[model samples]
Target: MSGTVGPSAAQKRNYYLIVLSMISMFVTTSTIYMVFPLFFEEYGMSGTSIGFLISVGTFAGIVSSIIAGKYSDSHGRKPILFAGVAIYAVVFFLFAFMEKSFTMFAILRFIEGFAFYMTPVAITTMVADIFPPKQRGKAMSLYTMS
Candidate 1:
């Protein structure tokens, strides 16, 4: 029940967590961005179509961020985080096997965008939970910087 507990200890713990979260975020974001380029040549996707696909995903992320943020603020964070990750993993696996179709890709990207925001909202909430008010800004800055 008890361990080395102090402000510095908590800060060190959170610093590591934030670093890991940032790495996760980078990988996810890179995957989302790279998917378009990786498949475009093989799938014969035009630049315009790829642009549209990315735009739709970005738009969906914006909407999902707002909705998920509000929803998580009211409800607990774990459920939303779990649901989001589940949706993301399922959709990503499906996308890997699905036939190349713009319509299907668009739908998948939309869903992915929605689920992706969950990680950010959840991690941010977790960071807030761990850090006090005065330290939260610095913690978040470190999270983003990493």
Candidate 2:
């Protein structure tokens, strides 16, 4: 038998899927960053309030990334990744119809941030799972560049 060993075909497929999902996630995230302030302004939210909303989401992201990374190690990556995408889709849809309640928006922002960070943390862990140790650096480099 040949001596070289690498990721199996299924692993390679999963790696590609993770890359594509991350690309889509990044696109959706950037779109939200661009559009959210304008959307909030159209509803008459003050600049400070808008900034606070963003800050709340960012803080949630920070907290959730830590929790989700550890959780993924024990619970598995795909479930958390899929849950994150689902939560993002639901929260994004909710944003369209949100009224002027700071509490409601804050809750959504926190959840959105939690959902957003879940994707990358799980995806990163998955990339680590897919490639062998010697190949991981290159795999992660390509994954990040994608």
Candidate 3:
């Protein structure tokens, strides 16, 4: 009686969840992306410095994703996702009060990247958990498009 039980249609796919996840990601990313140059200029950073700031965040994300992926496995997906989102919101809100210190902004950007990485890690893991092996690829594609 313990052979296996593949996802039986309903549990294997959830269009609403995928779409909502995508929309949420879009809003978060766009909010920062659309004002990249102006934000840096107002903060008095040169182009090279701005680029460096972005690079720091990218590098941090690489490290963060590896650690978060492992942590998510043991801690469960929902908590990671929630924490990530919460941290992300707090970081963005802090921007309003951030001083004109490039160093501070760079550090926060790195933190933002780390927190944001958790979202996708948790989401993809949650998707795989819900979908059957056979449908996983397709589900992933749909999620990615979102």
Candidate 4:
């Protein structure tokens, strides 16, 4: 029971997973939104359409977050998280190859909103699960920075 001198391998793994989750969250979210305006503008989308597109994602995110957050508590965080991330990637890959179809983009964005919001709740909870209560705040802060 006295082999290691510093943090255990498990702790290192947990930290690594937490960091990965945070990065995935930021990367997926930022990539979609950061290019939204330029992408839409190229097609001459009106202001109202742009507004509606943004709202569609936001509203879907809210609903997805609520549903996933509640389920994660009873079922467990990791499964939901993995499913969300996997589905999110598939959605993005599909989006990348999609033609200039606004309707398809809108649907994908709705699914994206659902998949994206599901992760933060799970990853945050996993961080809390991995760290002590006193350390959770700092862990969460590190996660949020991503």
Best lDDT among the predictions, by candidate number: 2
Global CA lDDT computed for model 3 = 0.78
In candidate 1 the C-alpha lDDT for residue 64 amounts to 86
Each candidate structure's TM-score, on Cα atoms with residue i matched to residue i, is 0.78, 0.88, 0.84, 0.85
Indicate the TM-score of model 4.
0.85
lDDT (10s digit) by residue, model 4, range 1-146: 22324335797587777687669667877877787787798778889888887788889889989988899999999888887888788988897788887888889888887888888888877776666666668878888888
Candidate 3: the clashing residue pairs are none
Which residue runs of candidate 4 sit more than 4 Å off their true CA positions? Answer: 1-8
How good is model 1 by TM-score?
A: 0.78
Which 10-residue window of candidate 1 scores lowest in summed lDDT?
1-10
Q: Per model, how many backbone clashes are there?
A: 0, 0, 0, 0
True lDDT of residue 105, candidate 2: 83
Per-residue accuracy of model 1 over 31-106 as CA lDDT, tens digit each:
7567658777888888898899888878988998888888888997667777887888798888879897889989
Over the stretch 1-146, how does candidate 3's per-residue lDDT look in tens digits? 11235555555445456557657866878877888788877877887897898898888888878977998899898788888888888988887689878878888899888888877888888877876677678878877877
Higher-scoring candidate on lDDT, 2 or 3:
2
**Global lDDT scores for all candidate models:** 0.76, 0.85, 0.78, 0.80
lDDT of 2 by residue, 55-146 (tens): 99899999999999889989999988999999999998997788767798899999999999888899888877777777889989988986
Better of 3 and 4 by TM-score: 4
